[model samples]
Target: MRRFAPLALSAAALITTLVQAAPAVAAGSVPGGGHPAGGHRTEVLELVARQTQTTFIDHGDPGTSQGDELVLAGDLLRGPALFGRFGEVCTLTRVGPEPDSFDQQCVGTLTLPGGDLTLQGLVSVTAAGPGEVTVAITGGTGRYRTAHGVIEAVNTSETETRLTLRIIL
Candidate 1:
């Protein structure tokens, strides 16, 4: 049951609920990689986000699930890319009785100039004291088709969240 909860949280609810509204990619736009071939490159995109909305859906009763929905608009703070946005709707299922630890999948869409990139991944929040979470970019669309990277989100304030994406490939 321990492994099953986290697996279900990741597989069943995360992808379908997180990704929402995104603009279409423009034709003839260049791909996300703005680098020359034949070497590994690490690109960092800093995004400043303001929480647009949030909804707490479940309280995590013994037989029930726990989770919430988060929406935010992120502006490019530093990077070659332009503006972006994402919406996360997910539920909380714990691996154990750890108060600060839980397993959940967040579904969200990362919209960029080229087009709307579907963001799907599993987030394992080991601690909850600080609202900081790390996510793995499992897959996406358009220029990000083969995209994989690490995203770190830190809450600066009640309504502000700082996101840094160390994107590779």
Candidate 2:
């Protein structure tokens, strides 16, 4: 027992020193966060989406009697991965007190590969035509936490919408 005392004390002291010197490791990460620039990472992912399904909700309100407001929801398909989805509650608030010709104050969310991008701003459709609408990206989370840019959605077909998202920082 006396002979083993020195060895045991040395081992204990070594372990204490190691523990004190070791950098703190995150639960599921190795020393530094899994990615080199976890929070400082900046990237751009471009994808084209074809509309899978779209629905327009009728409010039936006097203000929207002429269908000035279009409550829209839809899903989009991309490659073998069907990921992008969006919903818009918008109205023909610009260039119209009537229907069939105007822009809209559209509010919606676009679920991308990284995360959901909360969108809003004027959706110009009248001047661009039935197949195209350009919108502004307000904010988002996850990979797109500090995202800002323009998204141009063009209806490629009767059941398809091509979305171009140019993300900045």
Q: What lDDT would each prediction earn against the true structure?
A: 0.46, 0.44
| CA deviation > 4 Å runs, candidate 2 | 1-67, 95-99, 127-132
lDDT of 1 by residue, 46-126 (tens): 554444444455344543245433333334332334466565555554444664555665666666555554445555554
lDDT per residue (tens digit) for residues 75-139 in model 2: 54444455666666665454443343455566777776777777666644332244335566678
Q: After superposition, how far is residue 61 of candidate 2 from its true place, in Å?
A: 8.0
How well does each candidate superpose onto the true structure, as a TM-score? 0.57, 0.58
TM-score of candidate 1 to 2 decimals = 0.57
- The worst-scoring run of ten residues by lDDT in candidate 2 lies at 7-16
